[model samples]
Structures are given as C-alpha cells and as structure tokens.
Target: MTKFYSLGDSESEQKRLLRQIDLYGDTRGVAFGAANRVVELGCGAGANLWIARQLSEGSYVGVDVRQGQIDAARRRTRDLGIGNAEFQLADAAETGLKAGDFDALFCRCVLIHQPDPRPIVTEAQRLLRPGGRGVFIEPDGPNHYMAPGKEALMKVFHARTHYAYGDGRGSPGAARNLYPLLVNAGFKDVTLTPHVIVATGDDADCCRAFLRHWMEIIAPVADALVAEGLITSRELKQALREAETVKPDLFICHTMWQADATR
Candidate 1:
C-alpha cells in the first residue's frame, strides 16, 4: 500500500523511527513481566525488534511481507549483536507461526495498509497465549492533523495515493476505532492507550522528517488533485511548501491505540 515509511534510505528511516520511539517512551507499549517471546508485525529494519529483545531477554521475531525489508532487518540484528531477535518474511494476516506461539504481539503503523484488518487482528488473537497482550499503534488519519482548508486537499491526496498504490482506505480516522475492532476479534480485557507525538524543539526535526516523507508519499496524488477538483495544483504545491516551512505544533494530538488483550 502506501509505503510512506519506505520514503528514505532504509538506514535513515530506521534511525528516525528509533529516535521517535525513544522520544515517545519506549518501554510503555512493551508488555513484560510474565511475557517472554514477542513478535512485531511490519518490523521494518528491526528498530523495535532490537529494543524488544533487550526488554524481554527472550525470543523476538519480526515479520514483514517484503524480503528486502527482512534482509535489512537481518543485517541490523547481526550488526547489533542482538542474538535474541530474528526476522521472517510473512504476511500479518497469515504468518503461519504456530497458534499461541507468541507471548505478545506488537503492530505499529501497519494495519492501515491492510484492506481488512480483521484477518490480521484475528491472527494476532490466535497467536497470543491466554492472558497474553497485543499492542497496536497507528497514526490517526491525516485529516486529524490539518486545518479545515488543508484537510480537503489532504483527503484528496490521500485517496488518490491509495488508488494509485492499490492500497485500501488510507489509515483509520483515529486509534480510538481500534478498541471496538479488537473486541470484535474476540480479545478480552482490552485497554486502549492513546499516544500523541509530543513535538518539542528536539522533536521538531523528527516531525519535519515525517513531513518530507509524506510529501514524497503523496506526490503522485498531488499531480491529480486539480483533475479531481479537490484542490488546485498550485494549492497543493503551496501546501507542500508550507508543510516544510511551518513547524508542526508540539501539541498536535495523534492517537495511537495500544490495546492489551488478556489472552
């Protein structure tokens, strides 16, 4: 789908993600204490996998559909001497990992790409042991962040991008929708923890990085904005320029749903 994450060189994006993760509080989403083995879906370049390995002192497996991404992750694990972590090329909907094989599952910014998150959520539920937890994190849609005038163009660009890339329904409106969806997948004791990117001075650079990446991601769609009548080509260009110039508010609220299912 929209591989906005694959915008830059693998290493650069990896470092950026690691920094963002650290800024947002690394250990909060991690489920430990009785949990040992952890599996992270859409584990690009092993950033979170590396952290999870240290947090658990147990087995860690990262699954992604792309072989190139998997290879990159493998190299990263070896370079870091993270023996506890491994990478596998597999779809989250059907990873073929044994039922109840993982003590916990971590998914971040990946479910939006799936046409149907139901299968993935169902698989996650099946993969976890009874009382085990699964944490799902995703960006609240682009519409949530932009101004009313900017929001219209952003939506058009997002839709066109999805059509161009064959991705279904860009991201969900917010992480809040995840709680009910998880419950539908048969998860219990579900707790939805919402997280927003705190964009302080130090966090500004990272926010800017994401904005640049987003511009690239929506480039194709921007080209068609005029034809679609959603926004003029000039307006689209201005939006891109402004996105780069203006600093994203440190108080911007982007919700990430971290749900813990007992079992």
Candidate 2:
C-alpha cells in the first residue's frame, strides 16, 4: 500500500528541510552531550546532520525510507566535510540495525506519517540500550492555525489533512497523545513539551518562510485530494495564488510536541 509523504523527495524539499533545521534547531532539546551513539529515524536529507559535528567523540546514524534522501544525506555530509555520520535507507519502524546498540535515538516529524506509531516506538525501544534516551518531535496537526483569515488556505489545509488521515497514513495530531504511548511501551521518564511556531509581522522573513512552507505542503497533496473528491483543481490554483500573495503582516501559528523517554 502506498501512503502520502509530505513534500516528497525533491531536491528542493531537501533544501527546505535544511532551512527548517536552522529555524527549529535551537529548541530541539536533544541532549547531545550525554549521547555517545545516536540514531535519527526518518532523517530526511540529513537536515540535522550538524548533530554529527557536535558528536566529535561519538557516532551518528541517520535512517530514512527514501533512497533519494539517503543518497542526498550521504552526499551532503561528504561535501560539507562532516564526519562520524552514516546514512541508511530503511523504514523507521523496522530498521534492520542491531538491537540495544545505541545510547540515544532522535526522531523529528516522523510519527505524523505513521498511522500506527506503536511499531516505531517499539523499534526505538529495542534499538536502545537500557537507560538509553530518546527524543521525538512531532507536529500537532489538528491545532495548527493562521490568523487574519485566508479561508482558501484553510480549506486547502483541511482537505490536505483529511486526505492524509486516510489511506494508511497517520494523523497530523498524533503528537499530543505520545505520553501514554511511551508509558505503555515501558519507557521511563516520559515527558512532553509543547513548542509553538509563531510567524508574524515582527519577523518578516520568518513569516514569509512559514507561508512558503504552508503552500509547499499543499502542492504535493492537492492532486491526491482532487482525485479523492476532497478538493477541486480550481480550488488548488486559487489557494496557491493566495498563498503567494500573502501579505508580510500575515500571522500563522503552528504547534509541535516533543516527547522524551528512556528505555
């Protein structure tokens, strides 16, 4: 069965993920100092590959399902002269790597793509040594909102999310319920933190970038939604045009949750 992956493997998507790392890195709560061996599940294009630099005395491995992303990750790390990192093409839920081999595991924006995250959670637990730590960041899909009204954009978002929730894809709102999942999985020190992305007139460039990200999300899913009768082609065109014409004063806010646990 095929599922929808947001902003699929385009060269431009790689650049966008890199930019997203710059935008969200500071808040990522990854305790790199304590981690000697690290694994990043769903590590697209090595967006957070800089984590390798911080682990000068350690090693890092990035795993992703997309071969293009795995290849791009290797190329980017090699070209940038960043070492101590390896990229593997594998499904996050079942990476064929050794069990209990890593001391720390990090996942960002991965669970939202999994309709059932339990398998991935189990995999994370199995891969970590006793007392090993894991940090996961996932967006709060149902709660993301924009202010000052762009009804068309909202409609597109609704269509996109609704479509995503179908066809074996996971819910965008999966992050909020992670605590119980981790606890039930026997992970200790389970913690949840909420982070918000606020793009307003105060941060003009950031706001624009936020808008672009929002529109880019729609582009990939628009056709799927149309085919499913969730949206019309004309609606997609209008939404994209409105997205481009969004004013500098536009206000959009999104929320993501960070889950920290120990095996």
Candidate 3:
C-alpha cells in the first residue's frame, strides 16, 4: 500500500488539527442530538472523534490503517479521559465493522488517496443503519489556487505527488465524484456543499502557515520526485523557498467538496 503524506509526524498531526477546526468549527450542527453511534473512516489521530464527542452524546469508533496513528489516538483519548471513543487499526474499504449499526459515518480527505473509492462508499452504506447519514469531504484538486507565480510550480508538485501514490492511479480530484459515488452506492437524498478557503491581506499569516504546513507534508514527496528523476533538486528548493516567502497580496483558494446522504 502507498503511504500517506507525513503520517505520524508532529507537523502532520498539527495540520490535521488545524484542518479539523477549519472544516468543522465554522459549520454548525454537524451531528444529530439523537445520534448514539458514530464512526469515522481514516480518523488519523482521532481528532474528529474528539470533536464529535462535543456535538453528540454518542460512542465513537475511529478506524485507520496505520498502527502508529491508532496508538496515538488511543493515547489521546486516554489522556483526555474520554471513555466513549475507541480506535482500531483497519482498512477503510473493508472495516469488518457491524452492518446497519452506526447512526452516522464521516470521512475527510481520505477517498482521494484510493484508486477506486467505490468499495469505501459501499462499505459506508453497509455500515449505516436505515435513515443513517454519511458525510464525506474531499478536495477537488484541479480547483486549488495559489499566488500567481507559484501556481505552475505547485501544480507540478501536486501532479508528481499524485503520481507517487499508486503510480498515478489515485484520484487527486476525488471530491467531484462524491455525489455520483454516493448515489450509485444506493444512498438517498444526497447533497453536495462546497467549502472554499480564500485568504488575503489580513489573513497573510494564516495563508503562510497553511502553505508551510503543506510544504512540510510534501517534503518527503519532493525527495521522492528527485530520486525518481521527475524534478530537479534545485527546482524543489526554489518552490519551497517561494512558498516560505509570503507577500501581502498572497492568495490561495482550496475548495473542498462535502457530500451528505442517507442510507
């Protein structure tokens, strides 16, 4: 299996937390008051489960393929004295979880890494009870924006990074397929919502921080690109340097697609 970006690293963990806050904090009433069983697929470090705890009085189950992330999640829940959250090491596509048992299922930024997301969606449908809801969030890669001078280099970086995952078999633009996938998987009342992040002027610090975190996440991919003779070392360094130098007019728009449906 292809490895995800910067798994088990402090920087990646921080980025995950920031992303969770950015995505969930601004959106209100994400969980139902009556929800009693919730699950998260690819719940890296289980940050979202912690967030879910605040929204619903549910017992939470988080599943990830990485043992290291599972260990970290276990420690995090234990340290927080949360008794209702459980972490398991398992594949998202075939989690072996009970069928028709969960009240809600959530996944974020995970389906893009899969070469075919149908299995995961199918599994989600199976996992949810009748009238249960499923929420999925993923990036529409082609719509990602950056400052004028940095767009081309970042595009190249993204393309090379996508190629690194399963030799280009992964879908970098998986967000666009969420609606059709959910519908095809027998979900009803599917709805799509787009969340676009555009930072400018006073948000320069936030933009810089976001870009820096991305750089850190992709550093290993940059090294792999060089080793594969896909990009020159100097080119990678130049791109990194440009990302580090923030300008007042710096702007980036990342549009994430969120799809929700009932099983």
Candidate 4:
C-alpha cells in the first residue's frame, strides 16, 4: 500500500497533475466506452474525470489510498459541478467495494509502483461483472529517459528497475508482465497497445511539467535513497536546486503498455 506517487497533496503538485492530464492523457483507454458504471483506481485529484466522462457518462466511484487525494477528487467534482461521481479512500488492492458491482474498471500510471501488482489485478477481476472491461495503463520503467543527463533522476530510475527497492520483484517494470498477470487472474480477451511519452525541447510546457514530476518523486525519497547509499545528499540537493533552471535540452520519453481486457 505504498502511495508510490509520493508527491503529497500540495497546490503545486495538484496543478502539475492537472497539467499532466492535458499533456499525457489520451483516449487509448476508451475500451470502457458507454459502460453504465465505472471504477477508477488511484484516481488522484479527479483530473481524469473528464476523460472518464468521455469513456462513459455513467456514475463513477473513484478509489485511492490517500485521504488527501480523496478530498481533492471530491473537491474537484464539487467545483466542476460533476454530479455522477463519488470518491473513496481505499487501496486499489483492497477497495472494500462489492464484487461484480461495476461495468468497467480503469487505472492509469498506477500498477508499476506496486511491489506486487497481482492483488490489484485480482481486485480488478473481482470488481467487474461478467463481460465487464478494464483498461490498465502502465509505463516501461526501464526505458524512461531525461536527457542532458538528469543524473539524479536517471539514478532513481535505475535503482527502481534493478529491484533495489521492492521485495526483489522489480515492479517498476511490471508493465511487461501485464498480459500474463491479467490472464492468470481470470480475465479474458486480453489485449495490449503500445503507448509512449515523447517530449522534447520544442515541447517546452510538457518538458517542464515532466521535470516537475521528476522533482516531485525525487525530493520526497531523497533522504531514504541517500541513507541506502543509492544516491548522495549533494546529488539530491543539486537535482532539487536545478529543478526550475534545468536545461530544456531535455528529451523525455518512455514506452508503456495499455492493456484492455474483459472479466
């Protein structure tokens, strides 16, 4: 139950996530199209609600582990006058929702952070009714890049992919295992689409926004990483110090797998 996003509920972080929706959100998960009821796991800050609406005009139950995220989602739903939404504070793997209550299940950029994603996959299976669909989007952790040498960020990614953090499972690169995991969890009609995040110096806004994302993840875990000898305190300070002034020779991209399946 690691809130692996690690970026706490700050106004700046909220704004960054809102911008992330615009920059990276796509209709690739529209496999839930027209479903009558949906469940969105790890639905942080309700930014994805708009996209959720496009996929289905039905009621949605947004689930997350952090109370702050739940509050943020509720606040956004209220502010936007969105009527058919509800937010719950719960882990994705143990949602406490009734089984077979949803027509579709959705999560994006969620599973890779888990040390063992099997429980979440099984929970997704349990949440949906027969014939229900799910769209799970996860990144290729091993392929993520930030150019002009983002030393600290690169080290962080390397450590994650090398299984230095998890229970020797290396869940950061779990996107590659989605097919087998979902299949073994009793889901059918499994399909996967290749998704990519590509931002270059020309894409200034997205580049900076992505930089903010790196800082968000980096700053929170700097001390732990330093204590573990994975990163130095000086390197952590330098990374945070240069956050705003980081060179835009920045080229960022990562491969991702978007799995669409049925229960």
Best by TM-score: 2
All candidates: TM-score: 0.77, 0.92, 0.88, 0.85
Model 1 TM:
0.77
- Quote model 3's TM-score: 0.88
For candidate 4, write residues 37-65 as lDDT tens digits.
89999898888887456544678899988
Error of 2 at 120 (Å): 0.8
Strongest candidate by lDDT: 2
lDDT of each: 0.65, 0.81, 0.74, 0.76
Instruction: Give one digit per residue, the lDDT tens place, for model 1 in 139-187.
Output: 6554335442345435544555455423444445425568777888888
Q: How big is the positional error of residue 204 in model 3, measured in Å on the Cα after superposition?
A: 2.2
Clashes of each: 2, 0, 0, 0
- The residue pairs found clashing in candidate 1 are 131-263, 132-263
For candidate 3, lDDT tens digit of each residue in 1-263? 32454334464664565465554333444654444688889887766754456544578889988786787778778877887888778998889899998988888878887777888889999999999989898877667678766754585457564654445466676898888898989999999988876776467778776776567556656777778767778778778777877777777777788888999
Native-vs-model 4 lDDT? 0.76
- Candidate RMSDs in Å, in order, are 4.2, 2.1, 2.7, 3.0
Candidate 3 whole-model C-alpha lDDT, 0 to 1 = 0.74
RMSD of 2: 2.1
> Which ten-residue region of model 2 has the weakest summed lDDT?
26-35
Off by over 4 Å in 4: 3-5, 8-12, 26-31, 55-57, 160-165, 168-170, 237-250
TM-score of 2: 0.92
Q: In model 1, what lDDT does residue 116 have?
A: 62
